[model samples]
Target: MNFDTKHIVILTPGFAASEEDSTTIPAMQVYLKTLIKATPKLNITIISFQFPFTTQTYNWNGITVIPLNGKNSKIKKLFIWHKANRVLKKLNLENPISVLHSFWIGECSFLGDKFAENNKLKHIVTAMGQDVCKKNRYVFHLRKSKSKIITLSQNHHDILLVNHHLESEIIPWFIDKNDFPNLKENKIDILGVGSLSKIKNYPLFIQIIREVVKEKPELKVEIIGEGKAYFKIKRMIKTHNLQNTITLTGKLSRIKVLEKMSESKILVHTSTYESFGFIFAEALYAGMHIISFDVGARKSIEEWYICSTLEMFKITCLNIINKIENKKTRIVLNCPENTINLYSNLYDSNF
Candidate 1:
């Protein structure tokens, strides 16, 4: 290893388990990739420790990925702490590992804190939606950690402070400008991205589509991605007789999703909770108007129109649709290079 090049270890869920970015794996990859692209002065190596299910060697840009799994047993659950610390220790021996970062601060948080404390390494853990929202207060409180925990929005940070009794810095996620395309000459009606999960509330999105179609027959709502709530959302679409007005595009590549964003007039983020609304940031970077339910970590978006209830989301959607009809063009947003550079500096400082 180059003496000046820093080795950075990121503990996340299995990337091989899922397709990409939907979970922690790809999101971390995206951020690292952006950092490398925006700042070449830094030389960094990233090692990602995934769940036991992962058995593959993957590379992101120039970063080397090492996948490891944990044993499946009652003892294994209790022993995961030791197992994770062992893995981090083993990796540190090969290179000058300086910093340890993790996306979720619960299961992985303890592991990161343990590794950093044992080895005297700098550590940073981020609390995504599930960590601070879905996880019970008692559980989070019990797993208290001293590592700097990062949150994507002030709302989630407040939630963390209240629930976990911990203060978290708000570091919002960013979408690259290249991820978006020039606004399509002919705009489509609506686009939504996310798994067909219960928290996404796709059924409610369908109902809003039905209400929109009543006024504008040309209006359409297209949902991208499949999940546990897939068939349920489809059923709602069929029940509302929105076969023509609503469409589910299933899972799509990041570029393909961006293409859909380019064609759409607006993007709706209906998730009940999110750490940082990735799709919402992508939509904003794609220059599409967004009317989202006021839940989750959507700090990248302006808080001019926030709706806390389904009824409010419906009203806001209708209003945004009307504005879309009259506006000559949508806003184009460019993510700051400094934001990307921050990750690069942190990665390089790991040395």
Candidate 2:
């Protein structure tokens, strides 16, 4: 099974339909572009297990994408996997795949396992957030198998080892500093990013905002992103009588989000769980103060105002508001180059 060592196949849940599409995973789009930039001679083929699953080949940023229609019901998706397998076999015959990289551990890993076994290709899965959680049943078998696994943070790495006896490569997600806009003058007092779903815990974020707003009457809070908890968050804001002080901007483009980050003073992330808080890194880079719970990003950055208790978070918020009025510089650092280098090194490896 000698093949072009530089060629690789990437499988993911969703990817941006194009550069302008903001709905896809931001990290995945960046990863694909960076892969091409890091390995100039590499050939990339992306297979998506998501919508518009037409069995056709299309080019996105010079990478070929093959989607087998899996956006249907459970039974249809099950059949789509076998259909995808046939499409993949044709791809291998045309251009031998060097490696199979699954972005998440469930269906992608299952497909990766079958594809690699048939093609005799090396395989790896990046165990992201909930994919390696207790409920994803595939973790135990995926870990026991020979397939290599990688995690974005040590928290998830430890979870894999403790729960499944799996040791995974720790590869942090890298954000190219050059991609971000320069920080502008802070216009808003607080900001929240990420979905408005239950796990994101937007209600808690609103509570923290409420706490800080009480201390600084002029300060205001803004949230970006939308989900099932939209009306729930709205109801909470109304119940708290924060109609004028708090604002929900709905979902915005990544560029627009960065622009908004530049205009904000603090980022309050109240999520109960995070594989890696990309917004924490982005907000920090934008020179905004970050107050977040003990999660994945807690271990990576040192300057963030990490809070363990709600009481502590409220105190931290008030203290930050005081600093804002007094005028103090925020702490921030550039993205980790080593993280990108590690992934690039993996791409360059023969295995």
Candidate 3:
């Protein structure tokens, strides 16, 4: 079937409620905004399956967004899919969608793959976060379908290949350097970002801090973001008597988190896994050293130190802190334009 090359539709489970809602998938927000700015002539529309909790269509940064308000109820998912199909039909009738891009390889991809197969449209599914590692039934369907698949990092691509024997393209998300603030003096000695969830492993972060403070009691540490594990983490902080040494600044805006990164010396990411840790790029751009596990897109840069064991984390933290004055702040990975160009080529290509 012939399709209009000027229009594209994006499918996702959730999206930022408003332009000001920075906490909800900030990386995706940066990517979409950059994509819009880079391609002025392209028409983009977003179909959010389970966010904003409203059935209202609105505009965000000049792009049209249609929220289905699925609210993530398992029993109501089929009804939501039916409504989404109706919306897509109306949208296609008005302006034929050239391509369908879904954020995760789950429900959104399932719907997009089916619709695209029926309508002869190109579909692309980007595997985000745990969806690649988890036991998702949609992976099997997508493997047998015609939709193109993309993974954020090499780690994610390997996992998808091993788990489902699926091949995918790698398109890492990048940070926009222009959004950062001026650097400030290093007031906080250490920093940790990401949700306070079990996957993030804030408990290991607290344990690392507890060990570090034994040698240098004047250590100042701060953790940003909030999640279901807040209370348990708080109790651990209190029990370790780290109230003075550590501060929990729960859920800061994207700008505020960048500001904190500017004033910090080092970033310690203890997460068990990451598809592509956006924080790693953000911290590196802020000129902060990163100490993380061998997860995500592991780079060979000197400042990004990857650790394997708890002992390695402790040693790396101490070694970096002892000579923190000698470290320099430099831009490592700020390639929003490159990412945009890659996606633009994919959108214009024939599947």
Top lDDT hit: 3
Question: Over the stretch 142-195, how does candidate 2's per-residue lDDT look in tens digits?
Answer: 754667789888777887787777788988776667667776777887888898
lDDT of each: 0.66, 0.76, 0.89
**Count of clashing residue pairs in every prediction:** 1, 0, 0
lDDT, model 3, position 20: 88
**Considering only N, C-alpha and C atoms within 3 Å, which residue pairs clash in candidate 1?**
52-69
TM-score order, best first, reads: 3, 2, 1
Off by over 4 Å in 3: 1-5, 324-327
Off by over 4 Å in 2: 1-5, 52-56, 299-302, 324-337, 348-351
Q: What's model 1's TM-score?
A: 0.84
Q: What's the lDDT for candidate 3?
A: 0.89
TM-scores, all candidates, are: 0.84, 0.92, 0.97
Task: Find the 10 residues in a row with the least total lDDT in model 3.
Answer: 1-10
Of 1 and 2, the candidate ahead on TM-score is 2
